[model samples]
Target: MPAESAPVGRRERNKQQKLERIVTAAAELFSERGVDEVTTQQIADAADIGTGTLFLYAKTKGELLLLVQNSHYADALERGRAASADARTPLDGVMALATPIIECNRVQVENGRTYLREMVFGDPTEPHHAAALAIVGETEQALAETLSRLASIPAAEASALARVVSSIMFLTMASSDAEVDIAQIVEGVRTQVSAILPR
Candidate 1:
C-alpha cells in the first residue's frame, strides 16, 4: 500500500506567481528604460505574456507603475518594522526604522529615480491619486507611531515630527550628491525631539 499525496490545486498559486513575475519584469524594464519609455507591449514581452494579458491585471501603464511602487514600498515597510522592533529609545527605534528607508532607497534607486521624475504619469483627477496619497499618509502614520513609542510627545507632535523626517527622506533619496547618512538624520531627529522636551 502507498501513501496518498495531499491535494494541490495550483491555479491561484500559479496566477500569483505569474503576477509577481510580471511585476518583477516590469520593474526591471522600468528601471532600465525609464517608466515613460517602457510600453505595456514591452512589459508584456518581458513578462512573456501578450499585451492584452498584461492589461488584464492592470488597467493602464500608470496602474502598473502604481503596483510596482506599492509592492516595493510594502516590502521596505516590513523590513523597517522588523528592524525597529527592539529599539530602546524612540530615537533609536525611529533610527532603526530609517535604516530600512535607506535600504529601500538603495534597492530601488534606479526605478525610484525614474519614477519620481515621471510622477508615475498618474492623473491628478483620478481616484488612483487618492490611493497614492493614502500610501504616503500610511508611511507618515508609521513614522508617527515609532516617534510616539520613542518619546513623550503628544500624537500631534509625533505626527508632525514624522512628517518632517519623511520630508528629509524624500529629499535625501532625490539627491545623488546628498546620500542620506541615516545616522546623521537620526541624530538630527533626536535633537529635534529633545529640544521639544525638558528635564
Candidate 2:
C-alpha cells in the first residue's frame, strides 16, 4: 500500500488519543493549581480515564509534569534556534537562543524550578528523567550550533561553551526566589559569551 494510503491500527490510535487526553488534562490542572496540589485521580477524572490508566501514563505527579512540559520545552528550543538566526553578534546569538526558554519557564516559574531540581537528583532509570535529559541535550546542541556559527569556532569548543552556559543559566534561574528575569539572564549570557569569544 502507498504510504499516503496506509491505515493506522485501531489500538495505536486509541493509545495515542488516550495519551493526548492525559497530557491535555494534566497541563490544565497543573497550570491552574500547581503540580504539588494535583493528584492522579483528579487528572484521570479530567482526562476521562480510569485512575489505573492515568498511572500507566505517568507513575507520579512529577512524571505527569514531564509529560506535559516536554513538548513546550521542545517548542521553546525551536523558537530559540530561529531567533538566533537574526543575531548580530555571538553574544546576541547566545541570548537569542536562551530567551525563549527563560520566557517559557516564566509561565510556570515555581514548577519550572521544581522540575530543574528533580532532574538534578531524580532517578536516571525513569522515563521522565530520560525525557528531561533528551530535551536538555537538544537545547545544548542548539546553543552549540548557534555559538559555533556566530563565533566561527570549532563545534567541539562551541559544545563545551554551550554546556557551561546551559549550566549557568539553569543554576541562575533555579536559584531565583520566584519568577526568572529574562533580561538578567540575557545580560549574564552576554558577559559569558564575550568572555569566551575572541576579542
Candidate 3:
C-alpha cells in the first residue's frame, strides 16, 4: 500500500497559530491607527509572541501590512468580479469591478497607500510582496475580461487597456490627499476609464 501523508506535527501547528495571531493583531492595530502609527513591537506584544518570532513571520512593518492587506484585497477583487457580472455596458462593468477595490483601499487610507508603495518597491522575492503582486495581476485579468465585453476590443488590446485602467485606479488611490473622499476617487477613475474606452 502507498504510504499515507503525515499529519501536521506539533511544531508546525504552533507556528501556524502564531502566524494567525500576528496577522490578527496587526490587522486590528493597523485599522485602528494607520500603519504609520503602529510599531512591530506593539504587534508582537499584541500577538503574544516575542519580537523575534514576529520577525520570522514578517521582517518589517511593511511586510506585516502586506500580510494584513493582501487578504482584504483578494476579497475586494472577488466582490468586484461579482458586481461586474451584472453591468450592462463596458464602462459600467469596469466601474463595477473598480468600486469595491476602491472601497477596500479607502478603508484605511494611509495603510492602503502604504501597501501600494510597498508592493511597488518592496523586495519581490519576499512571499508577501509576491502575493500582493499576484493580486494585482488577477485584478488586471479581471478588468481585461470585462473590457473584452466590447466586441471591437480583442484580448491583447483589452489587456493593455486594463493595465492603463489599473494604473489610473492605483494612482488615484495612492496620490489623492487624505481628505479626498471615496466618491471623488471613484469618479476620477471613471472619467479616465471612459476616456480610454471606445464609444
Strongest candidate by lDDT: 3
Residue 91 of candidate 1: its Cα lDDT? 66
Better of 1 and 2 by lDDT: 2
* Candidate 1 segments whose C-alpha is farther than 4 A from its true place: 1-21, 31-37, 59-62, 117-121, 124-132, 177-199
RMSD of 2: 2.0
When summed lDDT is taken over every stretch of 10 residues in candidate 1, the lowest stretch is: 112-121
Per-model lDDT? 0.68, 0.83, 0.95
- The 10-residue segment of model 2 with minimum total lDDT is 177-186
lDDT of 3 by residue, 5-28 (tens): 999999999999999999999999
The candidate 3 region of ten consecutive residues with least summed lDDT is 145-154
Query: What is the Cα-based lDDT of residue 40 in candidate 1?
Result: 91
TM-scores of the models, in the given order? 0.67, 0.90, 0.96
Candidate 3's displacement at residue 47, Å, is 0.4
Backbone clashes in each candidate structure, one number apiece? Answer: 1, 0, 0
